[model samples]
Target: MEIAEILDFTVPLSSITLERVVLAILVAIIGWIVVKVLTSTFTTALSRASNLPGLVVEFLARFFSVLLYVILALIVLAALGVDISSMVLGLSAVIGLILGFGLQDSINNLAAGVWLAAFRPIDKDEFVEVKGISGKVVSVGILATELLKPDNTYITIPNSLVWGNPVINSSRMETRRVEVKVGVAYDSDLDTAIRVATDLAAAHEKVLPSPKPAVVVTELGDSSVVLALRAWTKTSDVGGVQGDLNRGILRAFREAGIEIPFPQLDVHLTGAE
Candidate 1:
């Protein structure tokens, strides 16, 4: 009778309850392992995706990891006979309210970042002009974009503004046009000035030959004739080539006895006398 009592005490819980508990434990373990494997795979794949940025890939990976963990918890709860409907509904409602009110700007920025990542309006090390700001793109992020200016200054612009405004990417192509303006005295030979400027542009090693550099009389100023020397060069060499052209033109003009004029005012003293 004592042995029977011991068995009865040990078997107080129903078989079904014991099975549910065991099942819940097993499922939880399995779900955890699966979540880890899947999240790793997902993160690796997202990182490889060409259109996605590093920040976005990382954000998505973390988000999905959390989501998978939540799902695993819900599954474990269901196996243990816990009602999750009301919990899910309540949690969703709270999240929705918080996101709706407090995270509007964040959501907008994230969306804009996604758009930029997908479309790729600007890229790293590329020169860009956007919203009156000019710089080289250093990095792109979910919240903002970083730019490095010519003077080594850094500018951070919100992704929303970057996506919303017009973006001019100067380094998007292999070649870019560089224009150098040379002004000469009105008495200088117009044809000779144009010839010398065009020759310098055509002779530059960085300048492309196919496009063929040209010189044009662009403007007639009060003190000088503004001649524009236009040439196409590799995007990476545009600045250096421009400087070279300006210096070469100045030297050539001096050798040729062409005078570059600056704006000046001559005063007459006849009224004072």
Candidate 2:
């Protein structure tokens, strides 16, 4: 009779244990399925928006989904009367500490990059002068931005530096003014030089006539009078026009017999004197 009673009691307990085990397994499987479904739905929705790059959106979706699944797994384990909160809490603390110590610089730089990319102090494909280097921007990546220099060299500057410093964008304006100083000999005709310079500027294909070209005698130097010739050209043509103007002005001066005088130092030997 005693043995029979013990066997009956043990059998009910065994049945209860089996039931809990099955229930927990079913819950885990359901959780996995739900995670897969949720991630697929998220990706589809994000892709339909299409505002951002597809690869970037997909990466974010998958990352968040994995994180959510981790949390879900912990919750299911806790529901089964598992005291894993302490373990989870400890793990979170350790991860937080490691990130705080190891990735602080990266986080700061990343945040600055995001700010720059969003606000656009400088944009991709624009000409910007930063860190004393001027170039056309090629790529704006997370950590760095690449530029193609005027001389055809490639430059990569960190976003941290770009965001931290001032940037000068030349391409922002439709036109840019160029100022050139052409000096003539003190004895040469000042009015003629001014007229030649203005006419030379007018002849250039890139120079704009209005706000009409301006020429002024800025200063009288030791050997010559300096004429400041100001003209406007499309921002894209600055380099070629500048070179062409210098050559044209020189050629015109030579043909017109307008002497561009070099500085002459009148040195005398005092002791010999």
Candidate 3:
């Protein structure tokens, strides 16, 4: 056989089309497997490192694995004579324009989600008060926040809203003030009333001793003198302790022969002012 004839005839017989197809398939499968294995390994290491939830680590692993596989697929397609870079740039521009026009709010929410996940301004199961809404965080999803309120109501706050405003966490402080005011007759001794209110506040089980409870004379009303009792308690126990202390103070004052004054108006029977 002549060299020229052999070269020309065998090239067509090699079946380059099927070879390319099989190679592409093999690349995709192998790339997927490598991505998953590598991601799993990293997840396992991170899971063992701290007290984070296993599901969180696993979720992060799968998410990153998908990202890695996308990059790998782009590279593979480029090697296979596809115009990957230009296509990716064009797609990105189109996506950007679409997001700017119709999906701005959704994109803002997604960006907020990423920021929250990375920075951890709040965590799962934490009791948080944001924008006058107070609740325990049930879940921090990719697009929205799920909150379980104390009254058993479910609240779904968008991630953008969560990140956009300033959050005040009443439960975040070490100690909180449990405050109440009581009115007593003008005839009652101010010093005795202060003593009684202070003693009552101090006797509560949840009240802290270091700061010490105090009674402040706030207002002199027509019917009574208002005494304010300010006591400190652990942030978590504020609500319960407040209720208990208020009830106890009232009962204690009653036992001490203190009169709880009510509003009274002396009727002057004059025709007109």
What local lDDT score does residue 55 receive in model 1, on the 0 to 100 scale? 50
Q: Candidate 1, overall lDDT?
A: 0.85
Error of 3 at 166 (Å): 2.4
- lDDT order of candidates, best first? 1, 3, 2
List residue ranges in candidate 3 displaced over 4 A. Answer: 1-44, 50-90, 264-269
- RMSD versus native structure for model 1: 7.0
Give the alpha carbon lDDT tens digit for every residue of 63-182 in model 3: 577689888888667545468879899989999999889988887886887776666676777789888999987776667778899999999998899999987666556889988989
Candidate 1 residues 135-164, lDDT tens each? 998877767888988899999999899999
Model 2 regions more than 4 Å off:
1-104
Point to the candidate with the largest TM-score.
1
The TM-score between candidate 2 and the true structure equals 0.64
**lDDT scores in order:** 0.85, 0.79, 0.79
lDDT of candidate model 2 versus the reference: 0.79
Query: Which segments of model 1 are wrong by more than 4 Å?
Result: 1-91, 99-102, 267-273
Candidate ordering by TM-score (highest first): 1, 3, 2
Local lDDT at 176 for model 3: 90
